[model samples]
Target: MIQGAGTVILWSATIERQADRPLAEVWDNLDAVWRRFNDHEWLSGKAHGHAHRVDGYARHTALTVNEQGWHPHFHTLLVVSRNMPREQAVRLAADIAARWVDAAEHVGVVASTEGQRIGLPAVALPTDSPHQARRQAHREAVARVQYASHQAWGHPGSIAGTPEGVFRAAAAGDADALDLWHEIEEATHSHRLRSVGGIFRTPAAPRR
Candidate 1:
């Protein structure tokens, strides 16, 4: 329920629909699951890249069509602002998968017994870790994001330009960089690529 500060856990999971559902509805289903996790996470007053909520969380998500044209799925990089044990994280992740199934049903979307699946694996990083270490975290984050976005709808230029490009842009204040992001969103018609809560955000806009 609680963890040490200065440490953060990064989780990677896929939120998937059991059947082919409308694109819009798929997003709704994922959003429902996202909210449930946010509401229940044990508060850990740790800072992300920037000062953030005591129990802050951040994520980078991309949508893709499941094997069949039946529905879309999400590859998400979930970041928790706390140092939690692997066992705890595993338990919580499994619970969240069940919650997603229930949440989608409640939302009047795909609620089948096999309706939604969120597979979670986790790794922890100290907030004050070295640049290389943080970049490694970002690498995992970027990989998931690109897999979803590129798989669903190919990007002429790699979404992040390079594997770590996404992390670099997270802090860029450049208008063009922002616009490129907008294009990415437009490609998928998604509201967000990276989601952040509390004082925590993916990256700060580079200084003007």
Candidate 2:
């Protein structure tokens, strides 16, 4: 997870109907897409500039390929820096979508996390029949919050321009917020304070 006040973009695509192609071929295509993203000059420049000014923003992305026995697709999650204007975010997302669509006609890409409503899974309390029920309950509570964060934010990363929302969501048991805070803290490991538990432990202060 990447921690910052930015947006996350998700790009996904289903495999084509070329049933005769080997699995390696599919992977190769996906790899090419990944390489293309890495090679994008705009991405590199924005990432470098953001990192230089923001103290902790940099390149944080996850690429994965899922294979459901003949039903294959790829998912990429990208986290950008904070304070970026929504227009710029939309433009960047559009550019990436255009690139992917150009490469694969069947690819389906969308940008979310802004004004979109998402449902979270039901909260599950830890088992009560164990001697370590208290600890288990704490862990379960954390997990519930994390899951909600992922669903609402599109990734387990920090959100920009929505600090209050992020804090509220996390306080409401969004586990991804904790994960994002942890990632941010880990990235700034040189700092004396290692834990972000205090930063997010309570609900965000009311906006002025």
Candidate 3:
């Protein structure tokens, strides 16, 4: 398991879904923002100097259909230095949120800062657990927060935002839901549902 400060900083936002826009087009827009933020803004040191504070990060994507149309968003978990102060972490979160909004605009999606959420790390992993147990606890922590991961339904806030709910709606003969399911499947056919970068990325194997 990757090491961290035992805290997870979450950053998420969605593009405004339009009724007339194809889901593939909308997905491409959001995907572009994600790529730009990760490449040019966050890791590239183009905007802020907080990139060094990040120890590692993971990203998960999910899609849902609503009255507004297709709602797709990214759930990014950033693990910062263990010694980072709360105030610094808060500033880092705010910076990331701002960059997210900027990234959206560059992609022609006018996203609001209010829609971007900066979830602070509220829980700390136990310090006394064995190595294996500690790894399990870390997985549980991530699974609990990223409900889209489909690892666990530990939170009971909303189901319509999950893939399971999309399928349920399709089963119920909801046309919008069916369309969303099909479109998302085609849009993300060769894409990864979850990704890791920074220090979380495994180093390339050496040639023999």
TM-score of 2: 0.37
Alpha-carbon runs more than 4 Å astray in model 2 = 1-4, 13-15, 40-42, 46-71, 105-208
Could you tell me the TM-score of candidate 3? 0.75
Local distance difference test values of all predictions, in order: 0.47, 0.39, 0.67
lDDT of 1: 0.47
What is candidate 1's CA lDDT for residue 183?
41
Q: Candidate 2, residues 26-121: lDDT per residue as tens digits?
A: 444544544454453434454445331211111222222123212224433333324445566556656555655454533332222221222222
Best by TM-score: 3
Q: What would the per-residue lDDT of candidate 1 be over residues 1-208, giving only the tens digit for each residue?
A: 2235223333443444545445455666667755654454423323223232234455666443323432334444445545656576666555546656566556555543343333333233345566556545545554554455454445545434422353357457756445444544454565565665543544577998
> Against the correct fold, how does model 1 do in TM-score?
0.46
Question: Looking at model 3, how many pairs of residues clash?
Answer: 0
Decide which is better by lDDT, 1 or 2.
1
Ranked by TM-score, top first: 3, 1, 2
lDDT of 3 by residue, 1-208 (tens): 1234455677766677766676677777888888877764465353656544565677777676667676677767776535456666677678778877888888888677788776764556443577556555555666655653333223447788467887888899999778767877787785677888754566688999
**Candidate 3, position 18, lDDT:** 65
Error of 3 at 156 (Å): 5.1
